[model samples]
Target: MTEDSSQAEHVAGTEHASVADRAAGGKAARAQTPLNSHRGWSPAEDRPDPVALLEEQNLTRVPDLVPVRHGRMMASPFTFYRGGAKIMATDLKDTPRAGLIVQLCGDAHLSNFGVFASPERNLLFDLNDFDETLPGPFEYDVLRMTASFTIAARNNGFSSSDIREVTLEAVRSYREAMIQFSGMRTLDIWYARMSEQELLAAMDMARANQKGKAARKASKALEKNALKNAAKARSRDSMQALAKLAEFVDGHYRIISQPPIVIPVRELAETFGLTAEETEAAVRDQLKAYRQTLQDDRRRLLERFDVVDVAHKVVGVGSVGNRAFIVLLQGRDEQDPLFLQVKEATASVLEDHLPKSIFEQPGERVVQGQRMMQAASDIFLGWTRGMQADRYLYWRQLRDMKGSVVVEAMVPMGMTFYAHACGWTLARAHARSGDPIAIAAYLGGSDKFDRAVTDFAHRYADQNDADYQAFLDAVRTGRLVARGGV
Candidate 1:
């Protein structure tokens, strides 16, 4: 075995007991890794260059859109941190860890958690992104999440004391929630979820604890804002997508071109030097293959919709350069439509340091990981390979009541409450994939892990800030090109 592989195995053996050992519960788990020792942060004397690591990731992404990725990462330190998951993965290799393994949301920053409609049409909050999901030390997700809160708070002009409090509260919530999950039955833990009513109730509780008039007013405003955002998300269904992205062209509905973000089917075909006949044929074959990945019922549901147009669209801060295509389909009439996003799935950032997944296709890794971690998933979720069989891709509804908390406009109370929600959501996700009994035991009923995580988050945010400056320097010196207005 390689040196890193051997070390990982050793760490795993020494830090966490096997499933049989885990039956001994918290006491046995604590004997393996103490909670207090998790405190402190120390950077390794030798570390990889952040810029080099980022440039390496760029190699796998689309060449033309790479500049746009750079530009988005350059927007702010927090934004840079979003795309710098690879850098942290490298740094985390040398950090102190308990070695308790779980299916990690490798990039489990604050914004990655959100509210989305479950198959039952109930809006539930959970870890919504799994592109970088992998099995690794559980604390890695906690570190990523806490640091994100700090980085975002700093961006929003939060005081140092406030940042620390928010981070602490987030960590505490996770610890307490894990304890709650530890005592529950397996089915209970699996069924546990945070719903819209529960979320608003949390906000109301926060609002009640306010001391000053201004604080109370801000709390009320945040609650009102959240309600408005939820309503807006509910309206962002396939019909809305059709209205915004499709137009009645030559008596048939076709995607509207809004270059360089959204490019229509004909435009993309010409750009690829393919005739309309070739492009349509290629799409049909890919769609047929994708249908096979879904369940029989969902496949039949997809058959009812006739694909009218396809477009290449830019999406997300970190996923800017990745190949993400939106397929527009009509059911019976132009008014009834469904939008499916067929996104290219690359090797996860965590794959380098973690065990390789058994699945042959990267899309399978993402789709399976998501289904395992989510409380409920999309009925149409599935995967397929590219025409050349060189690429993996997954398909899902474009946006069915998907929304995230707006961090930019948040007050201190709002931020703290949101942080708690994210922590609870993450803990529930971890409990589904990891041994909650042992994890809760390892954490214990103390603030040691909480304080340690807070410390690590602060230090990592400092490192991330410095790295963001270096990235800006690279762009300024033409070492990296960052396209403006992308």
Candidate 2:
């Protein structure tokens, strides 16, 4: 039997069990996998080479842009970790699980959590990236998140104690929040979400509680910066994209050419020996297929716009070499513009070590996972198969008031605060699709799980440093080519 089927059978009847029975089941889980056993990490004797794993992934990416991915990852160990989800997934599979499951973010590093405009036009803080999402042990996501804080904190030159404290805050907040969720009604848990205003107010309260003048001053500065970024995000819409990326040429608006990073479709069509008209027709066909995946209302809304232009756009550090394109559409008139991003969706990295996803198409797996995890998702979210065989793609607005914290500039206190927020948000997301009571009960009412995971984070950070050095060595010896300043 498949791993997913086996695991599903393990928890099959627990959902309908009494609360007391569920709690007992959680307690019983400790016998099979003790919480303290989660501490420490050691590469197995047969562990795969991390650099080789990255090179394997590059084999599937656009050859010209693979170096860009390498260069981006070579920026720092933290950046490498961001793109090393496959490496971590390999390592995590050897670790103990609580036998509990959740729809995982799969790559739940610190940067993946961010604020985006929900369907209701409200700014909501949630998991913003789902390219590698899948169902797996709940701890896998938590470990990935906590380890991210450790790597990021170290990159910022945080002291050992400060790093430990920050990492602990993330896991602790998750534990405490899960306990709270365990008591909430199903509907309340579903409705729970962190809004921008609520986040800002929380920051304000935290700043006010700082004890010293310098501390409070620093806190206030971070708060102000966050507020400024939120306001900036609000202005980052289709109008902004049109102003920055589109221009009038030959009497019509077309996407401006910025080769390697943003190449117009006409340029790409020539590379493949296809005419511009033929290329645009293929793009339109993909859009029509994607529209069918959307709700009736969304499909109607989409039909009002006409495709104007398309371009190849490289996006995100980890997703650099994947097939990604920006589609320009005009509604009513030239002034009404909408930009939709169509990105290639590959199988989740976790699928290598865990159960294969039930969804056959990778694009549908991503779309369904995002819809299940987020409290509210982008209105334009959908999926489609590309013209080429084995190419699956998902579509969403290019921008909708999206913003993320700049981890490089964060201080210890700022990181701790951010960690707490991430931990709480992750717990809420897991609560939605997993059994909060059983998972929370398994965690218990102590810092034991937090401390154990923190220990694992420290060890994993060391391993990441070693792997990063190996990657740099590969680039130096001509085993890998990296183009910087792209």
Candidate 3:
């Protein structure tokens, strides 16, 4: 709660400090805004209710699916963290920040960092979700990740000391990686990426000094699991999607519907209070406008496919209540099918708290931000406005070999390696979008900042756990409704 000169300068006015101001005064900025000073956490007495915040967010989402969203969040504390980005953002709005701006993953939890196919058909490990992407204080993403690791490790029954170590490793990796990036050439920083082999090597090195039989055994199992997951991710392409979600019914490809998760367009129309005829026509028009957003080659390539089916598909925890549709397009024959997800992109949760996006459309904001922060993006990535409803939707392949960590299943050794990977990826992402030099200077060559953030993570994770318990009580008392659990 104590403010330094820089903090006082920032808090005294409504106007934000200029990037130029910080660029010329990295060390001064560090002096003015010491990380060690902002290590503790205490929620304000006026802190808004978490359930109320969630209900406010649910106002813009699909009414029928909001219960499911609550259900997913009720599953675990880490799951709550995934869906509680808006809540945390609101809380952190009044907290002290270092004033170093960057494009935040906004919901930078451990599960959000994953392996996906690069355009060149190679597996790349990076931050994969951008639903809440926006320009904000770099610490927002760091805090989100650190707290996520702490909560996730705690869920797996790790001891408090072990959890602290995991959180420290993550923060340490991020600081060290940012420092490395600061000394690299601009192009080299841009080109720097974590490959599959590099990830395995990192795991190997982290566990190299372990001499215990149980430790070695756990390390080998962890490596094998990671490799297997990566391979599984690589196989989850359009064809795999077709096999899982579609079927050859009466000599034609049709998306199989499993209600509450996948409902065909005809059924989805009723939820919108629209007739089937009106729904199909509206979707057709949306696709036409969507083509214009694509590049010439991609647009031409899309022209070869004929839209056969569209269905409402429920996805991730935070996105459960939002409008998400998957379109099945047949190319050449039934053998060549492309599944494109048309997901609704609303105003980012960070929009009100951070610098507003230059792009007018929310979908465009997401697309542009993803392109800017990601080392490589989806080939078919684009955005379009809705025809039937007032919505902004981004279009991309539903599954481009996307694979994420199941935190509950991870052992201590796997958690450590995964935490480091997440930290390294987040640092690279920040370096790509913001001034790495200023950030690196602020972090310095010591573990002071890392330790400070580790302390913050522990306190925030405690907050998150308390919130999770409150949510369960709310559900039990009929104050809030949750449908099912995992």
Candidate 4:
């Protein structure tokens, strides 16, 4: 592989280059070339089918990752391919692109953005998950983000013109924010972010003035669930909300009671070289890993808390077939429980387009990159490896004041609020990992990039529909082997 090419199979000195990077890197560097011009590989032997890729894995290797009985729940053909992150990534791998390889939220669907509580007890909002975040052409993120916007608009019965306006607004905000950052001092851009006070005050002004339908909608929503509500949710209601999903396995969902989620903790003990009585030691090791993930100051405060209950719980569609666990900690009292998530690590879809790290662990890139990108991130956010056969990252809280707007429930203003939120957070994320000023300068004082993404979004939405149909065809023809054990 060409040493200069980011995703060239990571060969040290091989001649084979990634299909996208074979270009001498001039026009692409100038951001003048169309990104999709590099169709990486469309080999006939590559299957070109997402379902096939999902079927090829042993499902049991990362048993915690897979849904317990998805096949049966997915009885209808339409929902069968739901939450298939790897499948989606594999399909995209059929075509790779070139240009500025900032880290991407590989599957940047509109629904993935949300609000969650930070360790400082503030209700901070940003991109809520990064299971698929990795470095690749920034365009992939734009493409994915816009595609989700259109898909969401269509689902909400918006006219084409209205949908276009909403999505164009999203891209415009991102482009403009990047430009704004470019003119700032380097360190200013480094620390630049949309603060909670900034958001709350803006909503207050919007509410007082009735700026527009979108702003009014957002103000009303925020007013209904203000900081007081957030505080209650983070501290008082989090465990109850999590327990809502649990069942009475002999009174409660304890390790010995639940088979799968609890079963793995024992395996964790064995994998980490600890005995049954050395429970504190094993848990302490995981806490260390979690601490190292936080920014220095936050780690010190975490050192004081005593971990209370830890459990394995199934979570998320794209991550259904991956390992996910939660650890609850009590600092001063039982009321102060902090929940942390440890998700499995897997190869990135952008792996074929990003630089190889000396670190062999797969998901470290995602967890670290996510923290870097997010303006205000979960302090409990961190990663660990060697315990669950493969590596994984640990992050805090499942539903500690964490919430997302339902696509169907979105009104026009809600869409605008969501779009603006995405734009602001995306710019912040890009700033954290790359030269945001350069990106800002590239996008200065124009809607050209915004319009380009809207155009690309329209075209790619059609492509997603086609891909969705392709998935349906695979199911109809019995090409996709499934256990149907929902």
Better of 1 and 3 by TM-score: 1
Error of 1 at 114 (Å): 1.2
Error of 3 at 13 (Å): 23
Model 2 earns a TM-score of 0.97
Which model, 2 or 3, shows the larger TM-score?
2
Error of 1 at 413 (Å): 1.0
| TM-score of every candidate relative to the true structure | 0.94, 0.97, 0.93, 0.75
lDDT of each: 0.84, 0.91, 0.84, 0.59
Backbone clashes in model 2, listed as residue pairs: none
Over 332-413, each residue of candidate 2 has an lDDT whose tens digit, in order, gives: 9989999999999999999998888878999998998888788899999999998777889999999999999899999998
* Ranking of models by TM-score: 2, 1, 3, 4
In the range 268-338, model 1's lDDT, one tens digit per residue, is: 78766679999999999989999999999999999999889899999988888888899998899888899
**Candidate 1 wrong stretches, greater than 4 Å:** 1-29, 270-273
lDDT (0-100) at residue 384 of candidate 2?
A: 96
Model 1 poorest 10 in a row by lDDT: 1-10
Scanning candidate 3 in windows of ten residues, the lowest lDDT window is 1-10
Model 2, position 162, has a per-residue lDDT of: 99
**Who is ahead in lDDT, 2 or 3?**
2
